[model samples]
Target: MTHVLNRIILTAILALFAVQANAMWIQPDWYEVTQPGVGTNRYAYSGNDPINNFDPLGNDFSKAPGDYDFSEEGAAREEAEMQNRDLDGVTDGIIIDKSIGHLSSGPGRYRSTQKYLEAVASGKIGPQNSEISRKEALANIRDLGEQFEQRSLVCDASCEAMVPGPGQTSAIGASVAVVGGVAAGTNSIPTRGKFKGSTPGTSPASIAARQAFGNTRIPGNVRLPAPTAKAPLQTSNRVGTVVGRIGPIGAVVGGAIVGTQVIRRDSQVLQCMSSCYSTGFLDR
Candidate 1:
């Protein structure tokens, strides 16, 4: 009986050793062939510690529960920060360009007008027997008036205050824009059609109406009275004047509002960064 018991125990021990050796030599179900060093070792599993470590896919060991993947998180955060920096750079460039353009445009227009007038006065170009033909002269005069119209569109105080600088409130910018718009509007009404001594009644429609009425004669030697040169309700001159005055104000106000929103968004981003730093979510 004792000999039989010993043989049974010896067989069980040999089977246990065989199972352990087989498990040690067994290859993983999958291998990370693309990886560098350990990829060649098909039998290596979870850094050769199958007791404490596990790799179900056989490519990489799974992290313990509650472990944070700082590398991936950090990479994602870095990408986001880079994009934000790029956006900020673009925004700043646009703002600077806008500021410079606004500051230079009014003076540039004035200088152009001065040069044109000087040329006309010097007889280099004029309606008289000068360099240009009569048709060209008329076109040049019309272009000059159009230039004046363009000048009126932007030659206002709002152009200066529409873009607020750092630490400025949108309300202040909007208020300044509104005030400037009102001033421009008020100045434009009286000078609507008075481009270089031209009068409001000198519009083409008014002139045509006057001429038609003046030449019209009734039967039996009766003459029709010439009508006064009054502008129609929806004349181009009237509408242009109204729109030119109102458009700038609206533009300025809209710019102020948009600038305010951008500022708020930037501030929020800053606040988020600050909070993240305080909570140890970001490094200084």
Candidate 2:
């Protein structure tokens, strides 16, 4: 009995180590738009990368990179000149690139779906990992626009789910998707023809509505509206306008007018809501 127990403990330890070995988490540097004022702006990259020689800042900014090898001296000088150009320039927004990983050697331990599947079979990951991966894959596929073009959904404002009709619902839907998850702010994407601008702190039901259009089967006779432009929110409320302000009121009225005419007017609001939820899977 003692020997058997010893063997079991050894096996458990080995399993734990194996699981840890298979688990991988990484932080990548991403870009953001830094608008100084109305028209002047610059770019900033956050996160760590030995290639770029950046140190983690504890917070997102802490791990940011400052310098990059500029191919042209003129380009390099130009960027430097804009670093603090017109100190009071408005920071319009940041443009982020895809996450980049570090160099790895030796069989490239983490490679191929087959290896991931093996890890699952070996009890390295709970089924939840598989589910998450599947969902991510589906989302990526949707973003690529391939899944949308294949579907035959009607892109008309009169669609029962999109707009209220004789026997249909009137409430429209929308969604928000933060670029880098919760750490990132809520971001809106326009629905097929419903919305024309970005709505911060939006609702989840709206997000579902946008996804619904992506899956809706529209006929050829009906037309889908173009996606609306999204306006970035002022990060600090100290200097800004409220929904009740004259400017804000005008915007609201304008939005409603445009939204009413678009097919996916609610898409931005729904996506913004999903982006702001700040917890759990957006779909859930």
Give all candidate RMSDs, comma-separated: 40.9, 25.9
TM per candidate: 0.18, 0.14
lDDT of 1 by residue, 156-236 (tens): 222223443445456545544554354344433334445311344443333333343344333355322222224233223
Report the alpha-carbon TM-score of model 1 versus the true structure.
0.18
| Top-TM-score structure, candidate number | 1
Q: After superposition, how far is residue 5 of candidate 1 from its true place, in Å?
A: 82
lDDT tens digits by residue: candidate 2, 94-143: 12111111112211111112222333345444444333343443344344
lDDT per prediction?
A: 0.32, 0.26
- Give me the runs in candidate 1 sitting further than 4 Å from their true place: 1-243, 279-284
* Candidate 2 TM-score over all chains jointly: 0.14
